[model samples]
Target: MTKDLLMWDETLFRDPEVFEIDYVPEQFNHRETQMRELAFQIRPGARGGRPLNTICRGLPGTGKTTSVRKLFAEIEAETKKLVPVYVNCEIDNTKFAVFAQIYRKLSGHLPPASGTSFKQVFDAIARILQKEEIVLLVTLDDANYLLYENEINRVLYALLRSHESYPGTRIGVIAIISDMNVDLSREVDPRVASVFRPTEIYFPPYSADEARHILTERVMSGLYPGVLSDAMLDLVVEQTMKSGDLRVGLDLLKRAALNAEKDARKKIEEDDICLAYQVSKYLHLSFTLRTLKDEEKVLLKTIADMSSEGKEMNAGEVYTHAKEVMKIGYTRFYEIVKKLDAMRLINLDYRQGRGRTRVITLRYEPQRVLDLLA
Candidate 1:
């Protein structure tokens, strides 16, 4: 059989596994304080005491999920008193699904997906915990999705009020969210809120130097020494610092290397990095846009279409024009517009003028929207 010579030749990457999002490094820099605080909050669980519920909040890619995973690993390693179960609320946002995750984690198997009611799952979990003499520390990652689905209250009630159904069963939750502006106390049930006085731990955005150091560490571990240049690394750091998302930098590095490999190049150049950045931006924006409702997407398209250079349009003007694009009632249209604004997909500026005039502008580049929607 004929073989391709490049397969056996020197490659740009030494170990591509390090570039993966889930890859936890031996040295987790820039997040020691958060990690230590997490360990402290959950230490009581090791002694059969109730661990303090915690809220880990920050922007995406700021190590909220990573920190929690690291802590879970450490907790499991140290003692068997607490069972750490992690659930991504984006997938298991509902009470039944969330409880099923806990059931699976505690019982080593999942309850029947169908045929079994939520109360059954809840009771099973309680029985197992009481019999096993284990405290459950559940981490609800991407927890903001629960709030959007209006399931946060019920989910919290299920966890915080487990003791009501089964006495002496301790359940501690670590809620991870990207939106820090959300007021958890008001959103959750009053009873759950009173009990779930979480110790909030915030993961701030990485600075330029921190981003650089992180990218440098990843590059050294993931790629060959000479495959990426210092100048090229700077480009990634520059973009990451602006976005304040370390995920972007890591993604850019990995994608650029892949693109270079595709082009039969030995090293990643500036052009490769730039191209990867554009692709990454498009992917990120498209993912966010996909999450919007149909009405919101139409409103976003209208804003991108009607917006002019160095100027914004009034909400009234955009609404009038949006009807031309997609017909809808005024009240519903206004609500979708405000929803998009809240989602940060558009810039909504309320002007102080003769009337309560609100201006709206497309937050993203117009061409990008055209490309994605097309």
Candidate 2:
């Protein structure tokens, strides 16, 4: 190992060109079988075939998006049979926002965010597809968000039913939901749901050995050669499996690499791995808090207060409690709570088999969010 004050150019080492290295393979690993099956779904050009509705459910960074991208790339290269597009559902949470994203992406221009009429925006999208003579397979990544906003049905209706109005063009949906329980079929209108039965696949976290292989390959390929110890790779792989998040592994590698440079060291050791783990936790927890607005924080605290007082409630119930306790308007108060639910700072589950009056249950322990604010 080099001396702490060694003449290593930390910045140069800080940014190792990962892909240029030993082909960091996590983004593309153990996915061949899945990709092959996904191919036929998106390949609308096959005779006697129509558009396919497909769903991929997995933990964060389990390669849901990466796998789809890889499959689409193969489809694009080998066959011009279809047009493929992907959208991050988090970025398009609202009905209008989802429509706008599709419109702008297809039109090769950014849609007017608010001022333009909705009809004009959608019309432009329709015209573009017709003029280009393209059939699209739209992938919505992190699609559980659409359900939280109560916009999943509307979005599906627009994409699926569009063909009825414009027989010249076709739009097939490929929805990606992160959790196993996120239900797309339940959310779709029955008239529309019949047309939307998708091939669903689940992605499990890589095992310790598999994760180690994946992470080691990434470290060797992405970081300074010979920088990480065997122990460091093992620890990272193990922790990643525990977290069920490949992004956490990626974040650790990125942070540990930075810390090694900060210490003026050319090689990353086990201590750096420990530091990296702590830093990742700090950042993830901090990001969760940082994304919450001041009002959202206060409202969460209010929910925490109610939950602490032994009152179990749903969004509507919490909204009432928040109104009575804080004297905020019903509209503003409920809106903030919904945002909190969307952020995963709170969980909202409706009572099963219940009608329109069913409400949501908070998923996380209220104290956790409360402490973040305090």
Candidate 3:
């Protein structure tokens, strides 16, 4: 057997960080229209005025968060008058947690984790913004998570109406919702909806050609020349299009290269791409599962186990099993099912039995879900 092994010091990656999910590329392509609209809404804050509240709606990996991050970077570089604070609602889904993020951003330290009340934290954030005469531009990425916890209304109400309570506190919100099924107008409270009349920006999935161009750009910037051939790159692009997520394509490129390296090969092959996809395809699911609470994970695991055994459990049946493991009411179980459905991890369908019974099904293979959960 002949093998072309790389030197211990040599690496195919020119910059491995480029393939990271959170690494924002310097040259963002194919979303010029959305970026321009986002900048326009945020322009006022940059110029020392209150920025307009905005809604950025799109599917997962559609560049909603990236656009906001890129624009926020530019805004911060331009002036200190506009403070851009990014809150990931996936991790900070509660009102106190959300404000604590802003508090940390403004004050350069987090509020006392256990002792600080939400009102105290909110007031401190408001006072700092008002005192500094700074406009607060906050991007709530994955704001849908807040909607799931029923905290969206409170968060929005507080942010939008802060000026009413603490006069001269300028704050604007850019709520990024990846779940297209979420309608803010219907989901938020009437008071929040009234004030959060935002400029809506939609990010559609990239076209096949666009995906090809973007993936090719990453190939050139992230990997060494000749490491990924055109044919292999096309295969990666096809897989990315199938997933409808650019992150998957990036992960595929990185994973395929690693697979090639492990085999003592300088170049990635079709087999490398195929093997990498086995894990990369679940990138979204993996991320979603990470954000879930412990109880939520228990419920999903129960459903996955039953589904793996060819058991189609309805909401009540799954609730019965799930509650056995975790103490939760049926209403909470139903909400978890809906939240999981919105996250695209499961299919929540209503089948007409005695009444309209909710049938639970795993969106991915049951084994795959169980393996990931494990």
Candidate 4:
């Protein structure tokens, strides 16, 4: 019976990888304008001139990373003069690690992990670019991580202002972030910040129609024909629209397909989609909450406790409660709460109307958040 249970069903997935977040479609819908603008910026490098730096800012799952990667593929295909090297700042968060990434991309080998000064790594990068006579188009994905870790200024100086030290080598930066209000003037040196006058390109979240279109495309490629019903697809699209995250839709699609496959069914039923939605929400919340620092977790605990009775909280109420649990000042508490809001863990509204004192709402269910913390 066990063997029969494992052996009996027809599969629905033609290529499961198509549902992955990193999958690059041949035709990227709703992002053509931004791609064209980025291509134009790097156009000068093909003629041996320095390209203007750019900042690609948008909410998460808005296709910023995918678009840059697709552009890199295009640049590599068409140009021999420009070399595109992409790095995720969350992993390569320091100046030394970032330079090591550039080095590996250019030379096909990593520099010794330690005992190599940053100056040595930078010099090696300078020598390689100068020798190859090739321009470097460096992309820092999740760039706000660097700023939060206080590593952005040194990295910026190394990339944007390196031409001063090397002479005749061109390096362009494409900094990607989810936050739109990241100001470099406050963190970086004035000289380096001046050189990095980035042309900002914003990627807005998808509307319901756009989300449905994207889901349709994914379903066609990822699952067998007629596996997912149009009504079921609409349900997934609606859920994603509420979240404003495309990944949520893709996750739902993948999970629902898996659920269908698990029950030896050829078609995805509505119940499968509903189960997938709940599972995906729980997984996302757990993953995010686990990444927060202890202090941030404590703040989340305070919010969860205060809102346990299903009451909406204001900034002052949380502030007063958090003070008793943690010995933090008001200003610092406000900053941390705003950071949580930026992370989409909570909703913070500052209104100028009467009787409104910075309303705060926990975006996730309070009990669910507490369970995850435990």
* Ranking of all candidate structures by their lDDT, best first: 3, 4, 1, 2
| Maximum-TM-score candidate | 3
Stretches off by above 4 angstroms in model 1 are 1-10, 282-341, 347-362, 366-374
On a 0 to 100 scale, what is the lDDT of residue 52 in model 1?
93
* Residue 182 error, candidate 2, Å: 1.4
State the lDDT of candidate 3 residue by residue for 107-165, as single tens digits.
99999979778889988888888788989988999999999888999999999999899
- Summarize candidate 4's per-residue lDDT along 1-374 as a digit string, tens digits: 45323246457899999998789988789988898998888888877888878888887789899899998998899987899999987578788988999999998999997799999988999999999898999999888778765689889887888888999889999999876667544556787778888888888888888888988999999998888888888889988877778988898899998998898777888999899988665655765676677888999999988878888788998999998999899988988887788667899998776776798888878988898899
Q: What digit string (tens of lDDT, one per residue) describes model 1 on residues 68-105?
A: 88888888888887999999875676888888989888
- lDDT winner: 3
Scored against the true structure, residue 61 in model 4 reaches a CA lDDT of 81
User: Candidate 4 lDDT (Cα, whole model)?
Assistant: 0.85
lDDT of 3: 0.90
Q: Rate the local accuracy (lDDT) of all candidates.
A: 0.82, 0.70, 0.90, 0.85
Lowest lDDT 10-residue stretch of candidate 3: 1-10
Pairs that collide, model 1: none
Flag the better candidate by lDDT, 1 or 2.
1
